[model samples]
Target chain A: MSAPAALQVTRADVCCVAAAEAWRGDGEIFASPMGVIPTIGARLARATFEPDLLLSDGEATFVTGTWAVGTPPVGAAEAGIAYRTVFDIAWAGKRHVMMGPVQIDRYGNANISAIGDFFRPTRQLLGVRGAPGNTVNHPTSYWLPRHTRRSFVAAVDVVCGVGYDRAAAAGPSARRFLELRRVVTNLAVLDFATPDHRMRLASVHPGVTVEEVVENTGFELVVEGEVPETPVPVEEKLRLIRVLDPHGARFREVPA
Target chain B: MQVADKRMTAEQVVAELRSGMTIGIGGWGSRRKPMALVRAILRSDLRDLTVVSYGGPDVGLLCAAGKLKRLVYGFVSLDSIPLEPHFQAARQAGTLEVSEWDEGMLQWGLYAAGLRLPFLPTRAGLGSDVMRVNPDLRTVASPYPDGEEVLAVPALHLDAALVHLNRADAAGNAQFLGPDLYFDDLYCMAAERAYVSCERIVSTEELASAGLPTQRVPRWMVHGVVKAPNGAHFTSCAPDYERDEGFQREYVAAAKDPDLWAAFVADYLGGDEEYYQKAVARRPVEVAE
Candidate 1:
């Protein structure tokens, strides 16, 4: 494939919100290598206004721990809690994390374990890395670099983690779960504000339309008003994702 | 009945620990955490005490001495250091009930229990047969009217969750500086009583002079506060302090070797915490080649 064009990026809140304006369902679903690597994470990070726990690490090398919200669902392996907290001490706070998954149902449920059941898992997975907590935490979200019927199936065979509805059932400590969220997809944005709490259409990506998003979705999604267009990555934001992950981990699925 | 602070001598903290009690600590790998408390816990008469953690030197040291009755963890690591033989033995023998939950579920459970909830249903168990094995976790009909099935994980409330901090005032407000926020906020809030150990007790004036007070821990939530300098030693550096790699390597080598581990433990863990300190004193300093 020919290399995509390059550009610059900055931390602008408007762009972050604009980027997620196409998000669906409480912002719990996440796709990777991100519709464009770091595009989703950076936008979400900025959208969340960089929660206290999400602050860059002390040496500015890591973030996620006592000071950071829940274990980051995104890229947190090298990340460390910037707080003066001991290992066990950090486990005691509010953490907002994001994980990339394969399937996302209307209920905001996710599947990153196996493509199918264990005996004949269509696709093997990265093991039970931490999808469980990514969903169970008070406020957890998911990302799917690809937005399609297969990726957003009616039912994920293996529910490795959670989304909006499951988090809601966890009760009181879960107050922070559903609040403050969105789901950014390659095609459009999804939300979980309705009574059923299923994935609902908010807006579509730039140059993409409602018809295109509907064609890709497997389950019936509740569509609000005439969806507006999602924000296109300003040249600069596009550049950062490309720079950090030159391979385009963000653009999960190319134009088929 | 009185909980002590990090400023309290190790002996004072040891006095509160009793046999068969469940102890919760903070840490992961051999990274950031307060090892001084672990040392104190090791010396206490606490036996068959159930332990909980995300894995690290804290769990490693406990396992090395056959002091753990049960372990609640998502994952435990002393980095290259393999887990202690006793934990492995207990796990192999089914003597120890290791309730493996997602790191988030562990936090949610603790937080749930602290809030007096019955359980926390998480997406973590969907594919895994956790519900099948741990029957306690059951699926209640999803009231969503959409017929979405879900699991109900019983709340997990520890008797106590001890944590170590970097900076704190005499009032017990603490501060953390790291990448992974292990599980301090939830655990501290959820544990019936929270114990905090800090490296320094900033003066009221110093705290008052602080710019970001939101980052500072509040005194209200803390039950007991300790001020111990270099407390993160042998565990992890508090932000600035680097990991004690040399000590970790030696411990890993020693832990995997039963004879070596036994010898080291006999001299260190086998005896009192003070004897353990003496053992520390006896170690030969590494000479640069």
Candidate 2:
């Protein structure tokens, strides 16, 4: 098929492409994206380059083809893998979930559980739902529509998802399957690919400067020689994203 | 010989539960919980109990009522509302002892208990703060040449297990017609005494005809079955009814203030299950924004 005409790419579109890149090499595994933009990205990935990746209907069954975010799956009955089987797949390290963290540190330690002291938290978020298991079991990425100092903290309040330092310290079992893949935020795509596994600014989104990303981050990011702009989705990808998210939910998540 | 009938009322089931007992509640976040049984616990004088769950309103209600002395959970969240208000308040207030595990670790713990094992080795909690906060958790070194060490998630043995399903028989054979069973069977197997509350009590033949045989929780694993239609109210009992999001919003709003909470308790939770159901039916439906 001929590629569709190139259109004006929004930040949300760039974010979707960036998020989908997280699962580019994740062959045959479950692409469990938590929110709208990520969900669109996962669907886009499956529709395009990563066709083998499994996508759950966000409830019980594995689904193919895309539906609008927040709508029910049309034909989930055919691929009915129950919650039990999902757990089994997760434990066996065959899933890559993109979670949203309330706070993330330089080492990639994330917190979704609480804000302050564990004994008496100032604010309690969703208690480490599957962060601990997800991080240690398989490739775990994160998506943040809004990136700020509060989210990019120097040290997280509670380490729900294990980072490089903690994984190294925890020994081989922790390190074996641990893969903190990417942190796709509104501003940039970041990863812990440094020599010491410190979060490095991989690419600044179009119109967003490296200074802006560094300024918003709570801790020092390993900014290398030259940072590239996050790639815009091509005609085909943008068309697929529109098809997957017909209601413009990704735009609602990240805004135009 | 006649088949033994293992039917009981919510109150009767609660009567079987002693104070300070560890109870495992089935269902993930706000879905298909044994909320009728949970409401029964609320009406009773049960206090200082240790509650285990992939919690939702069950944890919130228990926390609001000062029922939990300790809580072992993966997370306490109302799916629509990210954080459960009462659970958050209780945690911030330091009102209850909390043992938070990774969601998978919680499952493994229950699975180990179901298998009557002391602990199950897993890599889930290894590098995360779950180990830091819950210092009592131990690690087991692999006996093989690799000697890989993994967190030994201890068995979450319960005094009782409570689960809500779509249908069941009087002899306590339960079946979930929903797409996901959400570890209900494992919860039942892990507990000493297990009670099931279902939306309908069908005949054995009807129960067998309802869903896949794998979905059925055999009578041997269940100690009692309580038939309470809409038993998992406020939570989604898919193929039955969706989560009462409007009611849940009111519940969350009430949790923010003591006066509102008291009024909510009196208006909704004050009565018996029948009254509660009627109160729910009588309330004006809320239009989603």
Give DockQ per model, in order: 0.11, 0.84
The candidate that wins on DockQ is: 2
| lDDT, residue B119, candidate 2 | 96
Model 2: per-residue lDDT, tens digit, A1-256? Answer: 9985567789999999999999998889899998888998898888788988888877788877667677876644447667778768888999999999889999889998999998799998889888998898989999988899999998999999899999999998999988889999999999999999999999999999999999999999999999999998888888787777778888777888
Output the lDDT of residue A228, model 1.
Answer: 79
Report lDDT (CA) for all predictions: 0.58, 0.90
- In order, the first chain's TM-score in every candidate is 0.64, 0.94
Q: Write the per-residue lDDT of candidate 2 for residues B61-130, one digit (tens) a residue.
A: 9998899999999899898888899999999998889999998888899999999999999888898999
Instruction: Please write out the lDDT profile of model 1 over residues A5-102, one tens digit for every residue.
Output: 55433222222344433332323222111223224454454444343333343233443322112123344534333323321222332444445678
**In candidate 2, which residue ranges exceed 4 Å CA deviation?**
A1-6, A75-78, B211-215, B287-289
Highest TM-score: give the candidate number. Answer: 2
